[model samples]
Target: MAGGFRRSGQQRQPKLQGKGTLEKMEREGPFKEWLGMPDLYRHTLVIDGDTYTYQVEDAELPFAPGDKVVFRYKEVKSGKWIDRNSLGTWIDPSTYNQ
Candidate 1:
């Protein structure tokens, strides 16, 4: 229910790796909270002017806006809906550049 319809306890694998500037993180909506469900948020990153959204499970990802980061993600498709799900640890910017 975060990015796409993941069956209860279903697992996902990263399809690719991406590096970019983390621009923002925003809660998807209050609808879930209103329904007494868990809160979920999506993170936005910009790479070469292209913006991507990654569904993040962590309430407190270490990276901040304007910080460079590298992450693994997988695209999930359910019907016509597509979403990017963040996987694994977010590589430290200093370590990533070197």
Candidate 2:
């Protein structure tokens, strides 16, 4: 592997959900070293005064600015969280059980 670490299908942590108004969304790059590599999409969303950023292969988001949304995420660090869904995972409005 590139960094002396074997790559595996590892889930970092259990997914948690949050709700907030969509303050912003920005997408950047299809950055890759080679032509055959997949495009990388960086998604940044500002929600409830906090910034949430992540990158993935897809460019789909469930909410837009000014929209109140319930979404899923997983904490990657002490206070850093990433959307559980590549884009923004949508939660049913009727369910806020978690």
Candidate 3:
């Protein structure tokens, strides 16, 4: 998963705790790359009935589909696994530009 703000259930409080004024700014930070190459293997997080695939290429980084993985382009750029339900949305190259 991208290294940024992640949504949690009501049981867990927000990570970026502060007044409303600064909360917005705090939410925005480094634009995490989610579509390079797989690095470290992170556990799978199924969200909204979608089975998202995650894996590690090197051994210490984490990455997901559409999201740039940790490794640079010099290595394997893409890998694949079966999406049984195809629940998650697939992002095209054009969307990444925005």
Candidate 4:
């Protein structure tokens, strides 16, 4: 799509990943404890002084509480933690301001 829109397949559609780069968030790393609620999808991440609300899949990773971090989404006017990756997992935003 030229409009930067992705045609999300059916919700039940399976994701065929061969486990090279994008592995399941649960087995990714230390932040695995922040896995999102699969059925509820409501997750919250407070960084700096702002609260970000976003939905995540069952096995996906949600934001974590930290001191200083970099969030790629500056336009969260929609009151939702915008998904920059669309993989149900946002980037690792634990890096402090440098």
Best by TM-score: 2
lDDT by residue (tens digit), candidate 2, 49-93: 888876677676556798876666776565545664544445665
Count clashes in each candidate, considering only residues at least 3 apart in sequence or on different chains. Answer: 0, 0, 11, 0
lDDT of each: 0.52, 0.68, 0.29, 0.39
- Ranking 2 against 3 by lDDT, winner: 2
The TM-scores, one per candidate, come to: 0.44, 0.57, 0.18, 0.33
- By lDDT, the candidates rank as 2, 1, 4, 3
lDDT for residue 14 in candidate 3, whole number 0-100: 27
Off by over 4 Å in 1: 1-14, 24-27, 31-37, 57-60, 75-98
Residue 45 miss distance in model 3 (angstroms): 1.9
Between candidates 1 and 3, name the one with more favorable TM-score: 1
| lDDT per residue (tens digit) for residues 29-79 in model 1 | 322434665666654545435556655454555666777666565554521
Model 2 alpha-carbon drift over 4 Å, by segment:
1-13, 33-36, 59-62, 84-98
lDDT score at residue 59, model 4, on the 0-100 scale: 37
